[model samples]
Target: MADKNIADKNIKVTIMPLGIEVKATRGEKLINVAYGQGLDVNALCGGKGTCGKCRARVVKGGISEYTENEKKLLSEEEMQQGYVLLCQQEATGDLTIELDGLNNGQKEFVPDKGAYAENITGNDPIVTKTFHQLTFPTVNDQISDLNRIIGDVPGKVALDLRLLSRVPVILRDGEYRVTSAIFNDTIIALEAGNTTSQLYGIAFDIGTTSVAGYLVDLHSCKVLKTAFAANKQRVHGADVISRINYTIENPNGLSEMKELVINTLDEIISKLLAGSGIPPEHIYIITLVGNTVMSHLLLGVNPLGIAFSPFVPVFAESITAAVDFLGLKTLLPAARFILLPNIAGYVGSDTVGVMLATKIYELSGNWLAVDIGTNGEVVLAAENRLLTCSTAAGPAFEGASISQGMRAEPGAIYKVAINDDVDIAVVGDQEPRGICGSGLVDAVSELVRLGVVRKNGRINSPKDCPMELPEKVRNRIKTRGNGLNTFVLVEGKNEVAITQKDISELQLAKGAIRAGVEILLDEAGIAELDGILLAGAFGSHLRPESLKGIGMLPDIDVTRIRPVGNAAGSGAIMALQSKEQLQIACDLPKRTEHIELSLHKKFQRQFVRGMSF
Candidate 1:
């Protein structure tokens, strides 16, 4: 009776940008309204109001008073500035929201697109062209121009209405000699002369922090050009949960985030086309590899379901759809986007790509694969007994959470070494703007060595720090501004410092990851793994020694640790080039297992244990 009464009170709300006018229950929270409308809101806490990411500006209607959670998460200035927490605000009446973009910073990871060094087994391009000369049709031999062209081709092929429009002139202009570009079983394009040589595909890895893409020549299976850019969605929120909450909180949030990613891909795609001197029409296929949440967001599917208890995804199998379906069809109208399959809720397709790139599934002995990021995924396998889990590592590793942290771009410090004195290496050898993930690891490792920080992540008081240092180094330590004992890494205008909370963030990140690794190893009944296969752009930049110092990695032979740069992207590349490779990706989920960390009887104990060094 109560459910029926609530259903009777449904109201309609209008959303702009996406221009959605949908029926929502009266007084329903904005996140649920947005979620029901298929909008991706930045609700990291699943509308619990713990994360404070799902915020929207109420432009048309008045909202209820702010809650205590809002006061804690948002600044008073921001609240007075008109920003309202979406989770706390209810749809009392019709409302309009203005979704803001995150200011652009950091470049995307673009792998070098040179000659194709990896061996490709087969040439089975979905789009290929065939050239044929037809006999001139007189009245006696007259057949329709469509049939005439179809007869000249080797096998049965249908002519698309779009391409059919060009058939008349194409035959006459080429004097019955023409090249027909066959996409799948249909002729998509007709050329006056032999233009069958141009064939390409693009493989992409969409990460939480960045997106990387590679353009490959289908004929030769060689990388022709590559392009990347920072994911424009970062401005909305830094992590997947944040982006999810945004959709839940804002009416048009989902569509807005989807557009941002597509635009980012379009930008990178344009550059690749320009650099390769290939027409967009020539690229026949694209394979996108990302976590399940990211894949859901790209498909404009609501991921809030996966954000809460009993986490589940809308699609677990591989998806192949025409480019037109994604709104960027103009760039590669003939292309079909292939999304690799996900292993489970949090362990996504990117992990499948990791498996393929590292060949860990087929490998013997104990093997541990960790792709550390905002959400860290760890896979452990002994022979065929595979186990995997995703730990909420937070955004510390990506130069997030820390006050002065930034992406590994120009002017960002990438490395550090300390003995008698401190030494640093900056990306592009420019002035130090901020420290990135690699440098953070380096600093933490060196600080531990120099006794500036204890195993509990407590910054030493000047007296607690046993290592005697120069006056300059000693002067860098101070405490102020909601601060704990802080170590100033840089001075001047671009002042950078690491505080007690900064170390705490790192501790949480590393602990979650390490605990996940331990759980997997314990399940497999192995004391230690044979080696560590680190994937992801961040993993590539991390030093084994630094990771070990932070207790993020297991104590293993230093020589055993290997960085497989963008293995997910490589897996996408392999999928684009070979059907067998794509099949291997699809088959991975069946053989693998996903372990729920929170549900584990020992998770709490391990988590508490992991919080320390």
Candidate 2:
């Protein structure tokens, strides 16, 4: 049975039996309306009607009529039961209808429409501590305003314009009772009447390739919301060196890049604030953690020196900047921006963020933390010595370097496991769409195990393969324009293929990481590692077994491998929460020794040797 009502305003309409209800806009197509609400009535080509898994029943209103496409996807028995294609049917009126059992599968945790602002970690450095009061202006005690404030305020307490603007109002409102937000002894924001209830902070891990942020409540040191997006500045260049070169080639290019990242951050912050139902003024501080180039870019400093000779950063110390400098206008105009210390030109804030979050500085045992991104930052600790370096691993892992490659999005193949027989268990359990970074590692490893690919990463002949290659795999070679060695992972529609060129890209990426580790160990005079801590989203999802099989990682005790999720974000949060920790972060650059692996001739030899499958 079905019921219908024509509603004038946007309303929530509950579908009978399914118990699903969503607020939809006026005149929205019913099928489209359902899809928008995440009703997973399957559409094989995602509403393109190619495989047609979205058949449903319109038991009441449209029972007498049927569309032509509906008949093609439904059987006579199904039609009698009042079946229809969910995609083809339109919601002419607010209606209730029965749902099929097949479409009623259990739901997974889909991210909500709003931003998340809870359960965050690593956000203490940027938030300010409050412990100061304002004085009233009296006619008899006519001490000049500047001198009166300066005399009472502690040493090195700097005040920015945003805080200066609100001083008079705050003084009058609080009647001299105020708690000032202090960053590194500098006044950032002032709260009247000893108000200290709602202190909020935002921690940002601005990578060269991507941006991840966490909104935190400073009072509880809890991360309230988290957001991640591709770095918009990447459209200009892929690597740090490339970006630096762009900056050097075009004088304003650096400023433009900085502006793009700031704008992107501002947008994300706005969305995050909206999601958390918090106002921008409530956020008292922002802590930014990124690579050296990224840190320099955020500060609008020229990174040309880093791109070229000597490779020196303008400053490696942690800096507390006014939010206005970065165009974060919504924050307490005087909101503080605390930047993490950088070890070197290449090893930037990201490494420091990892160090802070992992507590590598406090640990006594030999440890290695590898933050894998386009620029693979590695930190190795042994006894009293700490060494760090940046390896130019490029963007292969994120699927940027390869042709026809993409991120681990909805249809992307995120995993592949093949036995000796060469059978592939693809991710998403459907026709292969495109290969992701993790899937590439698995595919290469499985190809080696099945002898489909040779030890040197060459594609074997059809006869040499343990099992016959699929039409998809064979087509890669057949369709190659220059008679190059290419292998397709999927065929025809939504096809995914890998060419020799793609393999080379992966090879180069792996080589850089492997060489970096080896060089770091060689310099440390350490033969082996007790353990390897892999950090970052990419590193966390990477299968160690697959990585070892493909020779990306040394074949060691697998038990020693650990993935620490979002180490940079974790570190940023840690810095935001502790003033002591913030002080330690400020001194880390001075204490660290940055080793340039590219300058070493031995690094080239090691990288070449690591190219083997």
Candidate 3:
């Protein structure tokens, strides 16, 4: 009884910027408390104190002392400014906490458009509306209302009882004239007369780092509006394995993760509707494509199996469920939610989407398509074969796991070049706060080209730098308090730099991706001579020259490397627009061969070789 009371005892915690107050247990962690009240605290390491991303300021309360990880990760000035790691600190009393832009729901930058062959071969959408004017039934010639509506419809029509209940009212309301929304021979909705022109649908690409939504007018097969937001599941971790482990370790982790992503989709759907002045009921279907883990999480399926050896997902087949079952706020209840199929434990539907959008299966020549993100998925089409593998590239590219890394937002450095001196391009033209993924790639690419970083991923000291190297560039190399060498990008009161550990993280990421590419090439027993397609928001932003300079990509002419913007999202849009495309998406998993890099014999040696510049 005493233990129960102690566990139930609560204290107040005030979150700033929103000024929201919530009650927490007496000794609870502030990150947990904030997240419990629906606040998005940036804990990329799943509150394990490894990522050092959940840093918050304590404005009005005394908290627990820092741990060893905190001492190593936080700067001296940050500690002096009343900042503490939220995951490591316990709330000893009432507290007021302030979150930074990364945690305060700041808008993230995602590529709004992609380069896919916009030739939608067919306009036959999955859901279709047909206007019907039925003859009124009398005592002399009477027929059942359900039979009368579905008599002319082809195939075995599955009837929803709830929709059936409204049939009489709709038939009478329109005076025997009505429109029926049909999906896969299922009568999902019944509306008033001549409402076929209001048909619409939404397609979503649910990436581990971000979610992109496209609202399409099914009538004209045109995309009306698009929306993007950072994935809410990022608070748990930046990779799928971390998120899966989170679900295993916590009691309510699965449900919580599902709710977070659903919330992200809801926000995006609201934006799409508001921006286009479309009614929620007008949307008849929603199509989604994501990695296997993301697909599992969205459907409330436990992804524990996919996180371990002999990884096996509960289901890799396409799934179709109602929108209401998934807890979407602004979408209509009867709308069909379709999730495309997955190929393997790691090689998921997003890869399939990439193939669908780029039509890699039908390409005559050998081609390679790589979707760059925290979890990089690579596809190679050569010798009449399609091969794919997923690489654990980590969060280095998305600006996680680096000491001074952040998302591509305002004040983030997104581009860099080193000639006489280092020059950087910051997002929003603001001061350089930290380096993002593209900036990290650009900086390291320039360093490798200039001999500042060696082939073995070592940073040359100022004295050891080549005699021809410019002095201004050499002077930027310095050692920080952690005793690791760092290359300074912006020198100031709050200096932005990339440390030795950051380089190592990037090496591991790029090495994994390159290794995957090599393994696929070797498996096909072919030498690469064709073009490469970079597919994703991250891939769209990266420079092809920089990618090759860093040894992340193969040695190919810059013109051969092309950026297909958000091809996975484009695949989803294609599926939403045409039933033929959706069927192709469903059948892609069966056709393409998946190469499990973990079980491959040459992964370790190839990884080591690929790590070098």
Candidate 4:
């Protein structure tokens, strides 16, 4: 070793990754030095070395001090490779170090509302079946009707029994030419000659736990029909995290979930295609958006690494694949496939789809877009900077958990209003069968509004709150050793009850959303926001005033609050119509900045605080 005096001298260091170059006088702590250099090495445990995400690889000069905590978190191989805990190692001389991918990793999607309308069609791609005249068959050369049809179309064509049996009569009454109507590639109706009719297009929002599809005319984007159904992945796990965990735990769980979702999608595709009278192969294009997990599952990709430490997603850019590649038949073999761009591992393409549709990203004022579903993805941006994070908000609102909770399906309590006397107004204007997510929000909001629940989210009304032997609801509430109360949201005479386990689930969910927003704001150094835009079917129907009254929304200008419906689907549709939009989706990953919330203490503290009523 050289003279001790020289070793202890203040070391001038530069960290280039953050565009930060700062001097750390000798004896300064490593973490402080890193922070001073504008390098965000998250120390969730206040630099106690509890979390290991802040590992740094010393590229040049050695560190003077290395603590045991560094050794505990780093492998011998990594330690030998010059990796040091940024919180534990201090610079002794001129130094260059390799920071984690956080600084150089792919950027996230900034909220862009204007880009959402890029290339959406105004009409549906499906056409309703109708008839036209064809010349009656004559014996003059009496070519077979099948041969004539094969001759008209360039490609080899097959006939369904439904169409085959009608051919004789159709040819006998009409001429050689015919108008054919095909349902999902299966001929459903056949008449005479070329008839131009308005076509329809179907847009689908394939959520992880839920799937909603809309039927629209190809000529005009007017929505003609809509349908919703469960995601079918619940049988494997309720949330993405749990499902990922299950996949990690089981050998074939991931593949099973993937197959299940694809099958479900195929069935829906067939039903919708048939209902709209469009041949599956004839569908010119389909636009879809969902969370990373859902999209991964839909594409049959392994998602095991996304749930673990040093969290990373397999893909962040938008994807385009053949509908047939997904094992789902479509109307157009040549129809374009579009998937929305994802911001990060947690903030998915659905968020992009929503943001694209809302044009919130393009607004001049700073805006926040929160998609509150299985994952509470929050996007905040102003000027040129954008930040995003996702909270693991559970499935309580969607009626996945809770004793009496059900999905926002028929007979599910979707809305609720309570008076001082506790008289309730149920959705569908009928006796409440079970509460859906909206109803749950209404229940919690009403409870807070009526002083039945504390600001901290603790239930205050044990006697007045509907408890006791509904036998159905009571049996569902799960009990723990601590005696913390949970109520069932749904019960069935023959099915498992949605129990109180769901309430804790909801709290966790909402808390995560709150935490993600707080963490993003903290990272961006923003103390106040100009506006918050809720994007989704759920967000559109929610009462923002009540959401705020219950402390779910941040205090902001209420006038700024707005809803941009189905932004994700809209984004996908835009991509379907324009190559420019597709390029934007591809370029988005490079401009986004992802702030890891779990690495920061502020996120945890804020999450805990936001867990209240």
Candidate 5:
């Protein structure tokens, strides 16, 4: 441990754009300080200083000299501009820094609507409210307030001691008329007057990169509002393994991760309540679904075990607890929190949510569902069997790890079409800042189709281009400073191009996903798929033709491919609206079979074959 005198000294750091000031101990890593203060600093390599995504400019500061990683990753111009890697620098004195890239107030594109199965029926929510008009206690009939309120309620009614203490006051406040909020057999809350119509619940799909929330009316089973926000835990890393490593390396990492996600959920809840004009107390239940690691981190459980061989999680079953200690400021004191079950260490409740939303188990024909993200989860339902697997596709699809790649936000190139010349469509119709997942796929698909990029994932040199290729398109292929060929999509001051390295990254990502799909199909004895369902925000926005063109997905009729918008989130909403759906979600883990790709001998062979376009 460090000396007490040295540890006592403090340094001040002010972050720009947000103008947030924070205090840190002297000699602390700048990235740790920023993340501890709830700032979203991008650390794709988990502070190993390899990815160079956490670049920050120091307006004025006394800091440690850069490490070898920083020297290698930062350009001379950037170093001259006083830009330093937050992961590599330690604060020695007061500092003022400015963040860059997506965290710098970029507008993210979040899917607000999802496709819900038509078979889901009923409004029997897990939490319901019933108004009670009790008779006034007299000398002839002197009954206790708690007993009188739950006298006619069926089953073994249980109430918290704290809530039981307020029984008399609540009963007398409305002249013996009150509303009881029942969660199963427990009376979770009691209001002075009739609040039967105010019953509400919130469902959340907590992902590695983003969090999506839905507010639903329990009485009518209609979604009143939906909101989305970046998962604040992204400041630590982009993938589950990076986050798991953080938890292992840091003493308080698990709690910090839990707090960051809870804060994200609170922000989404605030937005949902504000948009719908709903009271916080009206939301009596909160249902959440996420991957196994995310679920472990949210509950302050150590997720290090989930990142290794013979992977084991602390708990794989559903959990129900009160939200009082969850740090959700916008929720009621009596609100209950429910976490859906996980199918495996990698195949989490999000996949279970996908299964629930698509009703894949009931489908008679062979169907494949893929939720694409940093980690791709594939599910196949066929021949009265359900199988799932996870592939580490990396953040290439989300636009990290690739040169000049970014999220699907404003100024991001999202669509590309190449004919005689390149035709690109950017998000927000603004100047292209960088390429996102869809645009990356589309661009590479077009290049492969046009013979600019070969099946082996190599970009053809300008002199070796096809004779029939247009001059404008051929001229766009140029060598960059790294001596590698790049295909320029937008030419200007902020030139957006796809380098040979970018193509390789895309190939690795798409290849892993394709390999997972193939393995699942083979395991289930599926000869052909009747339909393919793309789930999640990234998956939904991806064009079917481009996905197939790049060989990421199987070659099938385009009409059979469907985009199921945020299906995981839709399943969470289904659980929030109906108790039966919640039961189904909890039971899904048992029925589904998980295939561990790491132990599979055929994975490597399939992966190598899938890498080719």
Candidate 6:
């Protein structure tokens, strides 16, 4: 309590280890203040204090007294150590806090679209430019400019009212030689000279955490350049529900969120053109796919409908719009945007893209395709019919909720094994910073195999060790005076360890995923038949065996567990290049039945069962 004057009462909160500082007001939540300053704290539940995602250790100065939320979320020892949920704690005065490594700004490694580029070949593009030598208007054959341009176009072509005004000058400038991009039976552009071969389409995967954009030449179906960036709308929240709450609560928040994503897309466009030397006008088409909320946000639609019970989406069908509507600059005046159709209230166009890329909808035998992110989508298909469900796994796997968790960056521990001795494989062979999702899976699996953790996911103390373990293993399992147990994976300057609370977090996450899969399988009326395709950024590095051991995935043949990298993006790429592939994406959502796992009777039972290792 330094001062009563507003001018003199600036609370400076310093977050250490990163050496970041932010200005705060007294009585303001630490999470809200940090989030308002664009700091990345784990507010996956939108500062509601239910997720227990954002915890800070107050190194100096005073913080508000802990509430029941903090008491239930944080350990008593942690409370004694000045650790409190940033969402639950408020600023009392200037404070300095030490923070654990939270964000994983790792460069994702998704394969090029050429992996299945051939599958979508031979189909005509929805938009194609053809060079035609139009007969110039003569006195005897005086036809309107629009008619003259469409005479040699083979079939009937509708011209935009805006393009009709400039048709005369464009044709004269080209000396009766002009190229027109045909969208179905409509002529959208009238460009002078032959530029038919320079067509490009952008395939975008709008993930909750990040966005992946691919600039592809539709003529060759070749991916020219790729761009990746964190999603700008994450400031509102980590998941769609949080974003929905943001939109419903704040005025003009919808427009702001929409602009944020659009700006990101524009930046990606700028980057793609800058890196590949592709002319802006040459990029004419855009195919965007994401969850229902992201798709709605891109179109400036309020997504609160999908955030509550009896979830309903504004639009699940495919949509086509003018590129300029998104406030983006393009080289071609005829550029258009195509949003891939969404599946359900929760299952969105990204899943449609995944199905198109993997051809899972057309495949026979029992097949399960899962796209993991903040929200996990699982599809169980058996050729004729498919059952799909969305699992709220939170952001734990992406390294948000855990204390020593991080993204798969250079210094991250990506692989771990505890045999006679503990072995760690870092991402870039650098010093261990923190464990990533894959590392967590491997560590948990190894611990189970070594009998260090029980089947019910209990970490046994050294005195209660069931088997004689290596001294290194025994030393790592420590019980603090507060009676809380934790296992240290790496003991160094930046110590990396997993607490008992972390295990519970992981159990909740993996349990949700496992239960969702079981429900879909039960609905599909299949036990063990065919394969499981893990599709997304996290799946590429995940070990199927580890996923099985931790009960995140079913115990299936490792060979059947195929990691189809960025299938959603690849499907968008396919849709970008071929009208037939685009149709496949459009027709998918109607046939699949979306299940609500929370409303299911056996969900709680399965969730509890799956929580055990």
Q: Rank the candidates by TM-score, best first.
A: 3, 5, 6, 1, 2, 4
CA-lDDT, candidates in order: 0.77, 0.69, 0.86, 0.61, 0.86, 0.80
- Residue runs of model 1 more than 4 Å from their true location after superposition: 1-122, 136-162, 182-188, 329-332, 467-475, 479-483, 492-494
Residues 1-613, model 2: lDDT tens digits? 1233434556554554667776765445555666555454433232433234455566555332456766765778988877776656656545555554434432321211112223434444455555456556678787764455556666767666656767777767777676666666666776677656678888898876668788878788788778766566654555676677667777688788888798768867876888577878778778888888899988889877787768889988888767887876557567777888888888988788777777776677667888776788889887767889888887787666665454554455777765323344444565554666888888777777766678787876565565555544433443355666566666676557777777888889888988888888888888877777787777877777877777776656778887777777777777777776677777777777788987987999989878788
Model 2 CA deviation exceeding 4 Å by range:
1-161, 420-432, 466-485
Give the TM-scores of the predictions, in the order they appear: 0.79, 0.74, 0.94, 0.62, 0.93, 0.87
In Å, residue 197's CA in model 2 sits off its true spot by: 1.2
User: Candidate 3 residues 1-613, lDDT tens each?
Assistant: 9987875577788888778888887788888787776665567677888888788888888888889988987878988888888888988888898886456633345434344445554579899888888888899858888888887567678766668778888889988788889998888988878898898999999988779888889988888888887788877887888899989989999998999899989989988989577889888899999999999999889999999989899999999989989999887788899999999999888888899999988888889999998889999999789899999998898777987788777777999989999999998898787888999999999999998898988888887778889999999999767676789999988789988888999999999999999999999988774899999878988999999999998888999999988888888888888989999999888888988899999999999999998
**lDDT (Cα, tens digit) per residue for candidate 6, span 396-421:** 78776776776566677889878777
Indicate the TM-score of model 6. 0.87
RMSD of each: 8.2, 11.4, 2.8, 20.0, 3.0, 4.4
Model 1, total clashes: 16
Model 6 clash number = 4
lDDT of 3 at 75: 78
Candidate 4 lDDT over 1-613, as tens digits, reads 4787665786766664544556777766666776554343434333555345456777778786557777776778988888777766766677877675422311211111211232465322323333444334468857787666545543444455535666877765556556654333434345555543544445667776556665555555555555555566654445787667666777887777777776666666666766666655345456677888888887878887688766778987777654556665444443445666677777787777666666655767677888777677788886767677777776665555554555454345665565523333454464455566767776677656755555666653255445432333223344444576543333345232223444466677777888888788777777888888887767766677667765667888667777666677666665444456655655665666777777877877898878877
lDDT of 5 by residue, 318-394 (tens): 98888976778888677899999998899888999999999898998999999998989999999889899999999
Residues 123-170 of candidate 1: C-alpha lDDT, one tens digit per residue: 776567788778888979879999988887777888867566678889
Better of 3 and 4 by TM-score: 3
